[model samples]
Target: MSNNKMSRPADALVEVADEHLDKVLHSMAGETAVAHDDQRTAVHALVAKRARVLVVQATGWGKSAVYWATTSAIRSLGGGPTLVVSPLLSLMRDQVKAAELAGLRSATINSANVGDWDTVMQNMESGDIDVLLVSPERLANPKFAQRIVPIIEHAGLIVIDEAHCISDWGFDFRPDYQRLSHILTASGATPVLATTATANKRVTADVAKQLGDSTLVLRGSLARSSLRLSVVPGLGPLERYAWVDEALGRIDGSGIIYVPTVADTERLSGFLASRGHRVVAYSGRLEAGERERVEDELRANQVKAVIATSALGMGYDKPDLSFCIHVGSPDSPVAYYQQVGRAGRAIERADAILLPAETDEDLWKFFATASIPDVDNIDTVLQTLKESGEPMSVPALEGITGIRRGRLESLLKIVAVEGAVERRDDGWRSTGTPYVYDEQKWAAIRTARAAEAELMRAYASGRGCLMEYLQRALDDSEPGPCGRCSVCTQELPLGGFDVSTESVNAAQVYLRGADVIIEPRKLWPKGVEDGRSGKIVGAGPGRALTYADSPGWRDVARVMSGPDLPLDAEIFDGVVSVLSRWRRQWQRPVAVVPMPSRRHRLMITDLATRIAKIGKLAIIDALEVTGPAPTDDAASLVKVQALVAGLHLKPGVTLPTDGPVLLVDDTYRSGWTMTIAAAILREAGVPAVLPLVVHQLP
Candidate 1:
């Protein structure tokens, strides 16, 4: 019995939607799930008006309810299954269960469920599935696109979750989402509804423009009355870790603690765990099962918190997630809003705390240009493909074009969707599609990014009411001092941003004790050193005194990188600490060989001398580079060739043939130096090479 509520009178359809909405709410949220007025209105607009809508509302506003309810009504009216282009795997999982609660059969197609694709497609084709969800990546997949050509043709509704991603102006703009918009542009009157809680006025307008001018834009205030916002600025990395440790003692429920990078996630979560707080480190690095386990742990309140990077960004649903603490500031207010929105959704009051580190701007700067394609990069990629006259994989392109793997793939995807490049069964090839570089458009985006970074600075400074500031930044009509914010009341959660000295000191010990296991390069770079290729073996993981500009030893890091100085007692002790911990995992080394370095020769000599004295091992400073180290580090492939040619065991040097030997370096950058050094050591009859460095440049 299809509700086919579309044929009912306006008042009757609204009432029918209320019934369907409650069932959906009841299934996911339990009974007492009354439909919000806006939820029913949006459903009515989809069913009765057949309108294409964009809903930019705050989190926990039941935006999902509007779509689920409309799907139910449309299906009851003998319409085809609802087609949802979601952005993340977790969201698809959540929505599939949500569809079931609304009494509909649902299935999803994503990378994780490849085995079930045929079953899902069969179910979809047979009209047995009421809702079908696929990620934007799948929408761009050639196979899935071919399969869905007929599916969307009969789809009763098309929903774009996190629709802001369709616009280049979005905080998390993606090329695949833009493809979804193009699909809808041709899907003729299929009642498209795009939803996001993170779009600003420009993004909203851009999304609307993409959906067509007649699309209804329903944007509510960006304010979250349940969120109590505050920023604690000027914290160093150690202090940020300490602050979170201290704050957990006072906070009531399970929540998330966000870090800037995966390293920080490990650092903070380990520190928190040492303090007896139940937390887990989460990032894209985690396997699907592990990530699911962590998510379930948080959902069940089995753990106090999950320390994560932006990899845990969207679509993880936890209504009672009472807090969101950011260890570092986001680059933009929109990003900040999207992350902190995870909190206070179901609870009466949720704390949103920001511990803004001084180093945040550096990371922000790197990411600001990360996804924005550069003319030179695009040209290089295209030219290399043209020169090859054949399709080449991303790795081959990286080796040839000198672009890094991640950035190269991102560029390829953008250009592929734009028709400048095409992906084949084997790899990617140049399509010669003219890239119309809209200089003005790109410049405006860059300027907007800079402006948004400044807005985040303002947000972190408490320039105005926190809620009102975010609302205004997003162009929401909502304005005013949220009387409960730290700026308005001069009150702060977790006792006014003061971290315990006990925790800070513990953080120091923990940071010093943490192991920096540098994974040995798995395979030699192709297109370098006469195209060395094959699995790298007999090279075990290396240890480091510090990784990057470690918070616990930033001062020492600066001196080591800036000045050619001998190791200080403090830094030496930390190195010993790292060695003490790392030794537990590897066989003891019998000798120490300092990596050849011209720039920091004195420091390297001193470090080798100290290791020789302390560990009582032979100091074999036998290997040497032939010429001045490359003045500038080039791409991985180029640098490998330069380093391999120059870096070798000194002519006729005696070598150790048994067990692992310690290879020491003052620093590691691009890793080519250390990698080549280790390979040289192995070839010279050393069974294994264990590298140790003062700092590993990030």
Candidate 2:
């Protein structure tokens, strides 16, 4: 077995016999053509420069091949071992399997060590390993430092997979990744290589800055042309289950359903199984053996779909998957995009579905509640690790306590927190393995959330479009009205309608939680006078009316009877404020629109209903809810009214009301226009007033 190690072949390994390359590519499963144009360019760029490279490549672009090729090239030239720092243990295992399959000698040091840690250390020290694969946390370990660090220093190339972790602001933050700079600096003479699938401009710069002497190689198009994006809104529990059934029924290849919680994953898996679909569930709590069995099923194509949380996609690459659906909204767009990316990996047509629920506001609020873990939690986590007699690595700390990286650094700052955990020069250790999962830390998070009660309240109840807000935040470019989003395709009105004559007189107060209370005057002290009493009244359900007085008030109208008519702008503003509040308060779905007048309330309603049905709620604030007056029997009446009031409808499209209708108009006066509009709406065979208006004067 001593001679079993495959020596590095000379001459850049000569494409591994072409047949071998074909085998490697085909192993990716179903993806026969490796037409990754960007990846090819990036690899060539690195090879030509003979410089250390930081390659930011997207998933399924064959990033693994780039490293394998580069390593083979260096090896042929008598280069030393290539040290690869990967994220997951499973990835290390996969690398080993792939290397063995490729006729190479590779070894990995991780949790599933076949021998004791000391034996593994001796093997690496003896230089028996050709390619060494270690976890990010392993690189920071004192034990690893004492023995393997010297071996790694002797290596000529260092490869970091999923290098985006180094960019603190990126979606997958790991505190151990922050230490890569130190590790690379200490590696003495080795040139470094980096890779990842997701990163923004800021994160990209940070990766380069942190990895000294690095040449950046970015490959592949961010666009997933093969996948179709669809959103189903307003679906109840039964509808959600049916939707999943339908989506799965439509696809032939394997599929995945990503839910936000472990409980949901289990529930959905059971429900689907009851329906006779070969389904499985995977989550963090599952035993490793059980988890692997399910994964094997997915890889073997024995299961039609796997209902899981975010943990399912890492390490396992399945190209035949038709699509991945989000049973509920993810906490952020970064996460949503990442999960959705798993589908269509082989560049085939796939679909991503978003189903929102009424409790969505609560979930969104939960995100806001856990303020980046306070300085104390960091301190506690670090101090606990240090106090523990065992010399633990970063992953050990994280694995034991489940503390994420973004909050790790800050938590480490408190006086109670210890600075760094290191092995004694000699390596063996004593005091204690001080880690404890602090219940108080969770308590503090909850307290912080409670303090911001009003803000959360607004978020849960406000409405417009959830996807729009998520897209603007996640993608650098604007994805205006994705025609298929819950907001764009909604068929019912969720916002209360406004029927006012004096175009601007009827104020539209967008609301979350269905109720709001406002003090009449800003300067009034508590108990000085009874607070201004009013109802958030409007034509649609979520939309309402509120009062406000501001200078340069446009199109002013004095109220002769009803509470002082606030401008529609004021009402819209109030709605936004409430929604923002609800997001922090109850974690409800909320969106705010600036102009509540003239906009079609029905469109907003339909969008909200759809979102609620799908188990996702969003607070979207838009200015264009108004439509124009119809001129002919076939014109879009909603568009006609929207145009008359100069409402901001998404550009270049009219409401999809079927059939021509008679036109009707009236000056913005008390209920005059609504009365006329309603009469005409009935005559035109329009089933109901499209849910969009500032107010319908009673």
Give me the candidate number with maximum lDDT. 1
* Cα error, candidate 2, residue 56 (Å): 2.4
Most accurate candidate by TM-score: 1
Summarize candidate 2's per-residue lDDT along 326-386 as a digit string, tens digits.
Answer: 7767655555666777888775566766776654566667665443454455455556665
Candidate 2 colliding pairs, count:
112
lDDT of 1: 0.82
Q: Please, what is the whole-model Cα lDDT of each candidate in the order they appear?
A: 0.82, 0.50
* Error in Å for residue 268 of model 2: 1.9
Candidate 2 RMSD computed on C-alpha atoms after optimal superposition onto the true structure: 21.6
